[model samples]
Target: MKAVLFDMDGVLVDSEEYWVALEEEEVLPEAVGEGVVDDEEITGMNYREIHGYLDDHYGEHLDIGREQFETYYEDAADDLYSERVELIEGFEKLADDLRDRGVRTAVVSSSPLDWIGIVVDRFEIGEHFDALVSGDEIEGPSKPEPEVYEIAAAEVGVDPADCVAVEDSENGVEAANRAGMTSVGYRTEINQGMDLSKADHVAEGPEELRGLLLELTS
Candidate 1:
């Protein structure tokens, strides 16, 4: 592998728990209605695209408008990234390991650049990545559509087929696979039950994921 693209929320940092909590507690109830939405539908989607997705797929069930959905996520962004989340175990070492082996590393996420910035800046690990790719900045669709991962590969000057991606969301794994990368589904406590069948392989936790990436790219 010429590069390793990591999905920031779950793969590199344990932020999905916060996002899922927000979705389950308040976001979904106020936007798409409690029984109408699923975690997989918006977990890896760009925040900006989620309102439209809910409108298109479950408009009849909506209890709120686009503005409210947008407001909920935007308002939660700061605390979720800056306070509730922690970098996944072994990520700093893993990034350094890969880079020492001459492999490029990047954070590729469906989140906007500002959220991503909050993450890297808080962890003080922003220097580890060769590039920080955001879904909001992509020209086309984001995760599950492959454009974000494709762009990440290009930004790192590596062919998509030669890049390996570690993702913790269903849409993220699908996006990496569709981009022709070596896709590894990363499982954490928060996503232990998620279906990652689309991945080429699955790693159980941070240590396993770190080992797998090292071996795959070695």
Candidate 2:
């Protein structure tokens, strides 16, 4: 692989757990007014896109306007990414190894640039990446669509076929694969239940992810 694209939430940080928790506690019950939401249907979707999805799927049950629903997520994200979640174990070393090998790297996420910025700054991992592509910057649909991954490949000047994308959600894996990149499924304790069967490979933890990435990029 000439380049590696990483999904930020569950792949780079432990933020997904927090997101799921918050959604269960507030967004689902208070905003969308749903008692049960299948996260697989939403994870890897941009926060804005998520609003459209929820409003469409649960429109009849919605208790808030689009702006208010977004506020619910934005406020929670500020606390989650900045003050709560930690970078995944071994990511600094993994990123450095990829860069040292002349493999270009980028973070491809459904998050906005500002949210990504907080995690980058908090972990000081921004320098390890050549590009940071967020869904907000793309005009196309979010994950489960190939646009974001395609954009990431372009941003790093690599063809999609030559990039290995590591993602923690089903939507992310599908997006990478559809973009013509090799998709590697990453798993954490909180997202171990996710079905990443569509990926080219599955890495169970940070160490496995590091090893798989090194092997692929080698």
Candidate 3:
């Protein structure tokens, strides 16, 4: 593989739990106040799926409808992304090493464009990535669907089969598999319960991820 595709939230940054906590602490309480759905159900899905879950469980509590979930999340995400989001350890150095080796990289996220912007800017990864593809920017569905990875591979000018994808959730592994790409599953404390067996490789941390990437593309 000449290029690599990454899932932005849990893979590139340690911000997935921050987002889930927002839902549990603020959004879900405002939407259900009791029990709508646990973090496991909505954690790996995109905003659209999360909104649908809310609508099915406790739609009345939501001030806005499905059409407005994206906007609401975008607004809420800025605070979380800017305030708490941090790049995975050793990510900058790994990215530099990959670039030095002539391996291109890009981001494929289930996040909205605004949230992705916040992450990209906060981490200052603008120069490291050759492209960014947000689920919100595509017409198709998010992770667990192949569209996001397809777009990401295209953006990096590489065939899906020839690109290595790094992901941190079950949905992300499914998406990469469906896209006909090899994937490395990232295991972090925040995503410890997630199933990652679908990935071609499983990594416990950034160092392991870098080693796997190098082994794959070398």
Candidate 4:
């Protein structure tokens, strides 16, 4: 592979649990009342798009505006990144190894730019990436649509066919496949129940992910 593209939330940082908790326990309940939204419904979507999805499905019952609903996530992100988030084991070393081998590396995510910045800064891993692309940067729909990964491949100066994408969500795997890259589905305790069978490969944990990357780029 000429490049390696990574998804941020569950693949790079152990933040999926925090997001799931925020969505299930706080955001959904306050916006559309309890028992309406599920964690799976918004797992791989941009925070703003989560509000849009909820509005589309349950707008009639929603008493709050989208902007207001987003703050819950934004505030939670601040706390998560600063105090709670942890990097996936071996990710830093894997990123460094990829860069040493002259393979382009990047972070491609459904998250907003500022949120991506928080994670990168908190973990001090930004220098490992040749590019960082956020779903919010594109005008089109995010993951499960392939636009973000397509843009990411272009920005990193690699053909989609020559890149390998590591993802932890079904939507993320779908997006990478649609972009024509080799997709590696990552399974973690946080996403154990999600289907990732569409990916070209599957890695059960961080060490497995490292082994996959090493083999792919070797």
Candidate 5:
């Protein structure tokens, strides 16, 4: 593989749970009625796009305006990334291993850039990545559309087909596949029920993910 594009929330850090919880407990209830918004529906989607999705689907039932709905998520991200999130097991070593092998690595996520900064800075893993790409940076659709991964591959000076994308959600896997990258589906307890069948390969946990990356790049 010429490069590795990683999804930040579940692949880099164990923060998908925090996001699901926040949506379950706070955002969805006010915007889409209680228990109506499924975590899977928003997983791998950009926050801004998520608001648009909810507004489009559940606008009449919403208790809050689009702006207010988005604000709740933005405020939650500050707390979630700063205090609640932790790096995924073996991520530090995995990143180091990729760097030692001269492989280009990057954080390609549906999250905003500032939220990505929080995780990389907190974990001190910024130096490991050649590029840090955000969904919001792209002009059109984000994950599940391949634009972000396509942009990520370009930013790192690699062909999309020569890169491997590690993702935890179905939308992310679909995006990588659409980008012509080899998609490695990362399964974790937090994302057990989410579909990832589109991936070229599947890794059950962080160690397995490491092994998959090593085997691919070897």
Candidate 6:
């Protein structure tokens, strides 16, 4: 592969639960009226898509507008990701290996820019990636829509077919698939319950991810 696109949460960093908690604790209670927009709704969606889910489920009860919901999520996200999020083991080494092979690397996440920035800064993995595309940077849509991965490929200047995407959730796998790239499933603590059967390859851990990538490119 000429390039690799990585999803942030549940793939590179262990921040998926952080977001789930943020929704359960902060955003949903205030916006969705105490127990609306459950974990299932939050699991596979990006922030914008999450907002739309809330609108569809609990919009009438919200004491705010769509922009207000966005702001609340944005603010909560800032607080949520500020804490030190742990990096997946061996990912640094794997990233270095990919770089050493002259492969371009980038992050294409459904997270907002600030959240991705915090994790990137915390882990100091910013230097490893050639590009970082947050869902917020792209207009109109999120994961499972293909646009996000397409944008990442464009930014990296690589053909979609030449890139492999690493994803943790079904929506992310679908996004990568729709973007015309092979996608490796990244299963982690946060998304252990998720079904990853649709992925091009299933990696149970960071070490497995490294092995899979090398094997695929070999």
lDDT of each: 0.88, 0.88, 0.82, 0.88, 0.89, 0.81
lDDT of 3 by residue, 4-46 (tens): 8888888888888887777778777766675655765665578
What local lDDT score does residue 17 receive in model 2, on the 0 to 100 scale?
Answer: 88
Clashing pairs in 3: none
Candidate 1: clashing residue pairs, number:
0
lDDT of 4 by residue, 1-218 (tens): 99999999998888998888877787778888989766776778888787778778988878788779888887788888878989899887888888888999999999988888988898888899989999778898888889999999999999999999999998899899999999999999999888889999999998989998999999
Stretches of candidate 2 exceeding 4 Å from the true structure: none
Q: What is the per-residue lDDT of model 2 for residues 55-117, given as tens digits with 9 covering 90 to 100?
A: 788777777777977887888888898899988898788877887899999999999999999
Candidate 6 C-alpha lDDT tens digits along 1-218: 89988898877777777777776787778776776555655665787677676677766876656787678767766565666467888888888888888889998988878788887887788999999998887786788779889999999999999999998888889889999999898887777777788888898888788888987765
What's the alpha carbon RMSD for model 1? Answer: 1.0
Model 5 segments more than 4 A misplaced: none
TM-score of each: 0.97, 0.96, 0.88, 0.94, 0.96, 0.87
Best by TM-score: 1
Model 3, runs deviating above 4 Å: 32-36, 54-64, 67-72
Off by over 4 Å in 1: none
What value does the lDDT take at residue 82 in candidate 6? 64
Give the C-alpha lDDT of model 1.
Answer: 0.88
Model 5 residue 184 CA deviation in Å: 1.0
Each prediction's number of clashing residue pairs: 0, 0, 0, 0, 0, 0
Candidate 2 displacement at residue 192 in angstroms: 2.0
